[model samples]
Target: MDTLNSKKVTRRSFLKGAALLASIAVVPAAITSKDASAAAKATQAAMQYQDHPKGKLECSNCIQYIPGKTAKAKGTCKVVEGAISPQGYCLAYAPKA
Candidate 1:
């Protein structure tokens, strides 16, 4: 019946595919870091964040808080995949640390 010839997908091929998938999963983190860094730099240069003096967001009081050495440390956001402005306010802002 030529079973081997009729069928494809060997162990090596499957492993290769699995490896490819693993690598693909890690790509987003790398990309996010790059994009986040760029965004942070731009934000710092342009000063694109407002202080909620009488509002909210104080590291331990932010939804996207990651806790850094400083209160303004860049952290991940629920809406944004990368780091978000500690003082940055968005529509998806939530009160959570």
Candidate 2:
């Protein structure tokens, strides 16, 4: 219809819409970065993950260990949540080649 085609968004209305979108965009970053990871993975207990090594096996030697920024810093598991110690072990362990 001509009436619909002729309508134009006002500057105030456009800015308000943009502001709302920008605020919505910023909300996700306010959440802890690890929250998403936690949601997507299993809990440490569910995987029977432990803070100590199982025999000679350890997280640092497993295929799923995602190393931290530093060697000694805690790492994360591909299938588990929270800070995983390098010495930790889990049923999901698959020795890295």
TM-score of every model versus the real structure: 0.34, 0.61
lDDT of 1 by residue, 1-97 (tens): 7997899898999999999999999999999998876665333224333434225644346565565567777665544444555666544445762
lDDT on C-alpha atoms for all candidate structures: 0.59, 0.91
The per-residue C-alpha lDDT of model 1 at residue 43 equals: 34
Candidate 2: give the clashing pairs: none
lDDT of 2 by residue, 1-97 (tens): 9999999999999999999999999888878566875688988899999999999999999999999889888998888888999999999899998
Which segments of candidate 2 are over 4 A away from where they belong?
Answer: 1-38
Please list the residue runs of candidate 1 whose C-alpha ends up more than 4 Å from where it truly belongs after superposition.
1-54, 57-60
